[model samples]
Target chain A: MGGDNAPSVVLEGVAAALEADPALKIVLCGPDEVVTPFAANHERCEAHVTTQVIDMGEHPARAVRQKKDSSIVVGCRLVKEGQAAGFFSAGSTGACLAAATLVVGRVKGVQRPALAMPLPAPSHPLLLCDVGANADCKPAYLVQFARMAGIYAERILGIPNPRIGLLNIGEEEEKGNDLAIKTHALMAKQVPGFAGNAEGRDILTGDFDVVVCDGFTGNVTLKTIEGTSKVLFKMVKEAMMSSAKAKIGALALKSELYELKDRMSADTYGGAPLLGCKGAVVVGHGSSNAKAVKNGILVTARAARENVSEIIAQTLAGSDASNSEQVE
Target chain B: MGGDNAPSVVLEGVAAALEADPALKIVLCGPDEVVTPFAANHERCEAHVTTQVIDMGEHPARAVRQKKDSSIVVGCRLVKEGQAAGFFSAGSTGACLAAATLVVGRVKGVQRPALAMPLPAPSHPLLLCDVGANADCKPAYLVQFARMAGIYAERILGIPNPRIGLLNIGEEEEKGNDLAIKTHALMAKQVPGFAGNAEGRDILTGDFDVVVCDGFTGNVTLKTIEGTSKVLFKMVKEAMMSSAKAKIGALALKSELYELKDRMSADTYGGAPLLGCKGAVVVGHGSSNAKAVKNGILVTARAARENVSEIIAQTLAGSDASNSEQVE
Candidate 1:
């Protein structure tokens, strides 16, 4: 009812997830026609019919407010009301983010929720936060983003003492504009695992476990990577097919190239979690296939099971306590 | 005597440029030992002995003022005094930018000079401005950057009626922060070929001929492209060589792959120009080879011969006249 493939991909994803985890229960929220038959077939599934659907083109905040009976809104509401442990969407990113923030609510002391996703790197995967959350951000907000992201990286990602780096123009302390300068100074003092500063190049180098920036920059970087990778792969394929000799070489290297491609694929990580929310909320690409949809639900469940939101809340509370004590 | 392989690479570049263009004259600025022998060997070469050197790590503005006898300062002074039509440096970017702004000076009515470089896109190459100058910028300054870069693309890059795009978080005019929103509004009104807003992914897709942004964002974007390309190439090579069959495939595809890599290489463009300056000042990478250095000189000479500085000054004057007329 939401994504490009809609009910078919969604149903397959739910079925796969339930099959993998015997104890898992799914409450599918969509039109009665789409959800009723699927729910009736699966013993562990429950159908919750919705009257409306939010189009991807509609304004996110307005759509969320007006379409209370929309699948996205109802799904998030279930989490808020304790009926569901988490909410997952392969729908509009803005709609999902809006619904998650407005319906599921945010963890207290979090200024804004951010979407954190793993970026493929040389040594290991790096977590990039605020991928498409708050476009305009204050220095204090970035400090909080770093703290929350660090906790998630540590608790959920199983990376103890995750190093946090401020995304900036240069690695030097005095290199960026007012906002970056202020954020760097605050992060150094406030965050325990602050790893100086990370330039854009450093983000994908696996130099730091967590990198934080304003949503605008983070979103731009994410898209740029996606676009570049697409073009690069296309160019490589075209080059390989340009001549018989190249085609032979390409065929020979097919298996190895496939492995590399798999490593860089976003589908491997499922979906980006809308962090700082009280309940786990994950948003996948609109064009997500069955595997991606299944992975999205799995990641969301992992985040919820580990109590990622609670860990972030406790970390923020500790920082607030320290700040108040310093004031006294 | 700048760059990683200074003196040797610089000398070879100068020799190559002279060999290619017999009419071209070079004024080599360095210490006596380095410049004297090189200048003595070439009929079109002149030597200007300098007493000091500016290390890449030195503070740019301070060193430029104190080390007036340094090659960077001396070379820029020649342009300022009308002894040379342009200055090219394969030295520290900060020093080159500082010297260009302080010595060569800015165009009339130009608030700040910017560094403009061509990024290799999927279609044709596109111009990106403010890559490393003016880190923090006002909306008006970005409008100026767009205007100047547009002219550069039309005149130098030979793209008539080049489309100008404001880089932002989203493609929507209303989808950005304070600076982006203001810049988009102004650009839509002011620029004749304004194509509205462009996202980060749009930059590499060859959607716009000239994309303008603040230096901080531009610099980060440039580095990210470089880093991503480097990693992508490595991954492809690794994949291709994973087995004997792949090795044969990689060999067959070698020539085609080289062509693709060449198209994306920064060295193909020679150097980035510090636009809005009174004189042509081109800055190359620190690790520039002999060919890159020669190309940098060739590019600087072309800009000077075309009187790009004069054209920019006149354009700025024209805009000022129109603004005043509207006010009246």
Candidate 2:
């Protein structure tokens, strides 16, 4: 019903996830015809039928409000009604984000929700927040992103006392525009995990566990890396085939190069988690293959099992209480 | 006097450029001691000794104002006084951009000056403008960047009817934040060469000849690519060395890999041009080697020789006149 290859890929992904973990169960929400055949083929699977389909091209918030019977909207409704612990989608990112925020609802005091992904880095993994969530953000929203991502990195990624970095054009506190300058000050004052500013180059160097930015910059940076990596590998392959001697050499090193490329691939991480929603919601790529889809479901399951949202809520409440005490 | 390995690298670069192009002449400006020996050695070289130096960490606009006799200031002053056709520096980018805009001055009617670089793509080169000149920009400024960069690709890169893409979070006219949405509408209506929207991933795909963005996004995008490439190569090398069999394979493909790396290197294009100023200004990496420095000088010479600034002025004037006529 959603994504490039909707029902088939989604069915395969759910089957794979169920097979991998016996403790997992999936509730497939789509049209009766689309979900019934798949549900009949698998045990511990339920088909929650919906009549409406939200096209990717539609405006997210408007569609979410008008099309209450769409797969995305109904799936989020299940989470809100306490029937499902999480929601997974390979559909329109905007629609998923909108449903997660509006239907599943935001945590109390959460200014903005974010989509966080782990970028493969040299030393270790770097978590980048707000990849395509809130494009335009205030200084306070970035600070909240730092707090939420900091908790996620510590609890989920198994990093202790994870250092948070504010992404900016330069490492200097005085550098960057008004938003960066103000956010730098707030994070330093409020966040104990704040290690200072992380420049664009710092993200791949693994200098910080988490880098927080406005969604627009984060989205652009994410796509730029993806585009460059693709073009770079293509260029290498073309150059290798240009000469007879090079082709022979490339054949010998094909396995090693493949391994390197595999390690760099975003599919290694499954999908990005849309954080700050009440329930776990992982959004996979629209062009996600079977492997990526399975991994996305697995990631969502882990987020729900670990009570990540509850921890985030507690952390925010604790910080708020401490601030009020200091004022008193 | 500027850059990380200044004086020596600068002197060696000047020598290399002079040797390559016998018709070219250089006026070396620095401290008397540093420039005297080099000036005496070269046949056509002249030294304009300056006593002051601007440290990389200093505020750019402040340094330009206070340190009038600094090498950066003195060099740009020469361009303003018509003593040099163009200016080249491997110094602090902010200092160079500041001096070029404030000293050499912006082209008449130009809202903002931009730093444009040709990214080596799979098909042809793509020009990304405003890499780090203005951090916060209005929609109008981005429009100007698209126009200036469009003309540059046509005149300098030899691309006819060069396609212009406005960098944003998405390709939709209604997509992106307020600024991007506004800019998209204006570019569609105002810019003749506009090719609609381009996402971050489109920059290296060689889809658009010119991709215009605010300085912050452009700067972050540029550095992200650089960082990713560096880390990627390092990862490949490390993976190759993990086992004896892989090491042997890597050895066979060593030459091919090196060739691939060379092709992706930014050094091929020399340096990025700080466009929209009255004089041609080329800014290179702070850690540039002698080869990169020499190439930077060569790029500056070409821009000056082609009278890039004059053409930009004429084109801008023509557009303004036509726009006013349409309004009437």
Candidate 3:
């Protein structure tokens, strides 16, 4: 009900997750016809029937407020009411973000919730914050995003004292626009483990554990990488098919190429987590397959188990206390 | 002199261009030691000796003003004095941009000059404006950039009535930050052949002949594409080396792969044009080789031959006249 392949792929993903994790429990939220039969056949599964579905093109904020019984909205409500430990969705990104912010709510002292995605880099995944949230951001908001992203990289990703880099056009401190200039000055004093500025080339080089930017730049960079990789791979396939020798070579390299492709695919990470929310909320890609959906649920489950929200809250509170001391 | 492998590579490139075009003439601006020998040997090459050199990392505006004897400054001066029709440099980007704008001057009614680069797309090259000139821009400036880029695409790139797209995170006109939203509204009314908004994926898809954006986002997007391709190709090579089968496959695909790489390389285009200036000025990559320098000169030579600066000035004048009539 929430994704492109709503009921079937979602059900298959849930079934696979349940089989993989014996201790896991799932509450399916969708129309009765979509959820009832699946819940009946699965153990430790319950159906919370939703009456409506939000279309991908609908306005996010308006849809979340008006459609009370929509799957995205109802799922968020379940988290708010303590019925669910975490929520995952592959529906409209805007709808998911809006409902999570409105219903699940933000943690105290967090001015804005940022969308953080773990990009596949050479050595390990690098977390980029504000990927599509808060496109028009203040320098203060960017500093906060850096702090939150650093925490996520540490706790969930298990990288201690994670290095945070400011995403900019140039590596020099004085080389960017007003926002980047102001943010760099603030991050120098405020953010812990603040590495110097990272250029676009540094994004996939695995030089920094986390990078932060206004959502606009981050979003463009993310999509550019996706588009470039897709086009280049297509060209490579065509090149491989150009001659008999190349075709035979491609056959021999088939398994290795598949492995490399799997490493670069978004399905490996499964979903992007909405940071600064009180509840653990992960938003999957709309075109996610059953495998991606399963991985997304597992990531959400891990976030819940590790109490990521609580840890982020405590870290932010500690920073606030330190800031007040410095001001005084 | 200007680039990394200055005196030698620059001389080789000049010699090659001279050999290729029988009527072409070169006015070399560098220290006596670098330019004297080359000019003396070539048939149509002349030396205009300059004493100072601007370092790549020097402050742009300050360096241009102080280093009047530098090659970049002297080159622009040559254009201003009508001694040369165009100027080409592979030196400091900022210094080249500052010198071109301050010395060669701007077209009438042009607020700011922009850097336009032709990106190699699947079908044909697409023009992207403000690649690294104006970092922070107003909506009106972006509209002007679109107009300037459109002219460059049509006049030089040979695309007739080139479709222009406003680069943004989403295709919808209403989607984006303040600058994007405001620019989209203005472009729809102002820009001719306005094809609508283009997402990041659209940049490489060749859906639009030209795309306009603030320098910051454009720079980031450009570098991200470069970085992603490099890292992915490295990974592919490693995958091909994992076993004997992959090694044979790699050999078979070697020639085809090299052709694809050549098509995607920046050296193919040679240089980016600095549009809206009173003279044809092209800035080559800092790491440009002899071949790239030769092409950069060719591009500048063609721009000068076509009187691109005059055409752009006339186009702006015409657009301004039409806008005033609409207002009346």
Candidate 4:
């Protein structure tokens, strides 16, 4: 509802999605007066006039009630009442997160939710979880993340035996703190199909399909990698602009340079899924534009059709060996 | 020295170092036969024949005694005895770290030694500490790392008021657990000019001059950044080579691309220093060639001239700041 550029970018995204899939359904969740004008210009959004506006400025969980007819509240209600499969937001992340947790709640046996995103590596993109969904974590939560991420990888990525690794300070089973040590033991014994300890570097190295970590470490690692990439690209840009020779050289290399830039764009990575939820919801980038939103919709649609949540439940409910294999 | 391309790379680095600096001196500490022959090839090496050959296969710390005659051990002895300003190794990190603590010893008030590296960024380089120095840590150790890293940024890079930051999982001052929270408190109380708490992305964002963390978290952050960069570079190369036009385009951009690669070279920032030691020490890349080795020596010489160790000690000695900034 209120991401970067807000209604304009989001409205364009909705249009793009409708163009690609004529039969696709959508329920916009934001201020009616603001969004109605954008929708009024669109011919495809016929007969779907539902007004429930959620203010981007409000604290999502608490102020959500204040805007009783807000878009987010309505969107969330649609999902809760079976009118929609899931909710998508490019608005206040806190609001989206609060809504996702409070509205849909957790699946049975899932203690905390994880935010999983595919790292755009040269190798097959690896899934790193707990980006910011949960701050404090227990060993059991990490183990469940491994199991959950593994199933998603197998179904979504089609990677056979999707190896699940617990992100730690080291590769040695006994090397990390009490949390890592306990998680390692549990992964080795209780969690079937565990791939053992994977260090931070291994996250993007693609040594494992899923890198499971507590929210604290996971969010830090994710941000570090992103920051590093930006700084490096900036360096390249500065170097290219430094001198006449370099500038001339950059002119000649602009295509290849941009080709590299496009590969690292956050938009290319569609969305960060709120994993282990009953519904199929995906969170697009806060700075998302038309293309990214379109991709987010498609991703969510696929997850819904694929019944990812159902698979997660069945996987967690199955036998030790079956669950273990399913975990990958 | 168990890093990628261990002995061979280490050998090339030594060769490079000896050739570059006329005032430079070295005390080789690996296997005498392995390091001596190469040492002999360089002209004016008549005064550089000292050697202590340590077994590569032996436990790094324990091997120090068995191969008391090894290069690492002997080199460490020289530093311990004040004959050399620093020890450089591209060999066993465990052995190097062990010998650094056991032989040279730590400065007063410094709990653990840290391996600090300067990662290439868009705006100047960023200094990250405790890359892989110690596994576990006390909040006190993190406090010490900030002081030591601050001194390093000052004398080496000449960045006055170097912004020292604690690499936490989150930017919120109150977000982390006992370790992060306690560390935050001490840093706020003790550090000279500290930047509250920085997230993982801040490192590459060039937001701070010195990024500090415990060995476990720091090591993970360091490696993950490296891996992500590697993967990203590879992706650019692959995209450039995917098609005929792209390949042709890449050829036009080859010079600029090479410039980018050179600017991003890990060794360009010199070597990772073993901070909080009695003397200056640098660890070149295990696979380093002549230039990296030479650069390491120059880095060590600069640190020695700047009295980096003494400044770090003084910083620790006057940690409460009641004594004010110590002048060594």
By TM-score, rank the candidates, best first.
3, 1, 2, 4
**Looking at candidate 2, what is the lDDT of residue A175?**
87
Pitting candidate 3 against candidate 4, the one with the higher DockQ is 3
Worst 10 residues of 3 chain A by lDDT: A319-328
Q: TM-score for all predictions?
A: 0.97, 0.95, 0.97, 0.87
Worst 10 residues of 1 chain B by lDDT: B319-328
Model 1 Cα lDDT, one tens digit per residue, A113-181: 998887777667788988889888888888888988888888777788998999898778988878889
> Per-residue lDDT for B203 in model 4?
83
DockQ of 4: 0.46
lDDT (0 to 1) per candidate: 0.87, 0.86, 0.89, 0.74
Clashes, model 2: 0
| Ten-residue stretch with the least lDDT total in model 2 chain B | B319-328
**DockQ winner:** 3
Q: Say which prediction, candidate 3 or candidate 4, comes out ahead on TM-score.
A: 3
User: Candidate 3: misplaced stretches above 4 Å?
Assistant: A321-328, B321-328
- Write model 2 residue lDDT over A83-183, tens digit each, in one string: 99998888999999999998999987777889998776656678899899988988878878899888888877778899999989888899897788888
Superposed by TM-score, candidate 1 places the C-alpha of residue B301 at a distance from the truth, in angstroms, of 0.7
For candidate 3 chain B, which ten residues in a row score worst on lDDT?
A: B319-328
> iRMS of every model, one decimal?
1.2, 1.6, 0.8, 2.6
Q: Considering summed lDDT, which 10 consecutive residues are worst modelled in model 2 chain A? A: A319-328
- As a TM-score, model 4 comes out at 0.87
Task: Please give, for residues B1-328, the per-residue lDDT of candidate 1 as tens digits.
Answer: 8789998998999998888887788999999999999899898999999989999888899999999999999999999999999999999899999999999899998989999988888678789898989888888788889988988898877889998998898777888878888888888877789998888888888789998998988887888888788889988887776777777878888899999998888876678999999888999988888988998888888888889999989888888854342210
Please provide, for model 3 over A105-220, each residue's C-alpha lDDT reduced to its tens digit, 9 standing for 90 to 100.
99887878999999888789999888898789988888889998998899888889999999888888998988998888888999999998988888999889999999988888
Which of the numbered candidates is closest to the native, going by highest lDDT? 3
